[model samples]
Target: MLDTAQYRMAEGDTLPALLERYASAAKATEEAVAALPDLDVGVPLPRTPWSPPEPEVWSARRVLLHLIRETAQHAGHADLVRETLDGANTTAQR
Candidate 1:
């Protein structure tokens, strides 16, 4: 894990810079996942060297499922926020 302190953004940070950072990280993550061997998908994740240590690590498949679920959850939140700002209806009114 990275030192969280260094990644913190100041209050004056620009939106484009923050978005560029997100894009870079996302692209790197995608590339790393793509480079992994196909046979390792079901293997257990490596143990971390943390003090308390991780209770349970997830397999690649579980990680992928979690990513999918999280993305869906965030998308829902974004939709609500957008609707609130624009008064645009995302769903059919009953």
Candidate 2:
């Protein structure tokens, strides 16, 4: 389980600051992924409550694909929220 306490927002946190941090982290991840010499390298998955019963290994390629999938999912969710707030359909044809 994640330590929610450690991830909680600070008292003065603002949306802009949070977005800036997210952008920086995303850029760093992109750079790191690009610099990886081999995508076939694998690592043992961490054992967690939600993880599979048997140990499994994930390759760098798999991890990258997972990250891309997750990011796209989150972006879609964010778009939904934005559309709800502004009554603008982001995906609608112009």
Candidate 3:
């Protein structure tokens, strides 16, 4: 099996390559979650040493909430970046 150190990429990778890797990882995550049997969102998550410093732990529902919040944050930032690069803006119209 590959060692954990092999996971780190060398400095030569391009932006597009990194973005593709990110997309693939996200897709795999979604597929894994979709495969799980339905359960209550409020079910308590298993405790792990990697728990966040603030909450210390989270319910299964909170995990989804965090994912939604993070995805929205990144998408909003991407919109701003795209607007800066091209003249196009995705602002809402009345």
Candidate 4:
């Protein structure tokens, strides 16, 4: 895992710059995934302190599913925050 502290934005960094960086990274990831010939291909997992004790390999499909779930979780959290600030139901059906 990366040391996130090292990648923290500088004090002078603007919101637009930060958003643009995230957008670029997301596009790159999408392109890379699109190029993959087989989503079932598995790779040895990097053993970090947070990793399971047992050895593991993760297929590309599993990784993508995890990413999707995590993104949804974050979006939910953001919606909660937004609702707290203003009584708006962003996810409610129109």
lDDT of 1 by residue, 1-94 (tens): 7355544688888999988987998898688788878624664554444425545656676777777799899889999999999999767888
Clashing pairs in 2: none
The model with the greater lDDT, 3 or 4, is 4
lDDT of 3 by residue, 1-94 (tens): 3245434676797889988998998898688568657533344444445544544444555767787899999899999999989978867877
Tens-digit lDDT string for candidate 4 (1-94) = 5455545778889999998988998999799789888999886676665678898999989988988999899899998999999987857586
Q: Which scores better on TM-score, 1 or 2? A: 2
TM-score for each model: 0.65, 0.70, 0.55, 0.72
Error of 1 at 14 (Å): 2.1
Q: In order, what lDDT does every prediction score?
A: 0.74, 0.84, 0.70, 0.83
Error of 3 at 36 (Å): 3.4
* lDDT tens digits by residue: candidate 2, 1-94: 6445545788999999998999999999789778888899886776665677798999989988998899899899999999889998846595
For candidate 3, the lDDT comes to 0.70
Q: Among these predicted structures, which one has the highest TM-score?
A: 4
Return the clash pairs for model 4, or none.
none
What's the alpha carbon RMSD for model 2?
A: 2.9
Worst 10 residues of 4 by lDDT: 1-10
Q: Name model 1 segments beyond 4 Å from true.
A: 1-9, 39-53, 91-94
Which ranking of candidates, highest lDDT first? Answer: 2, 4, 1, 3
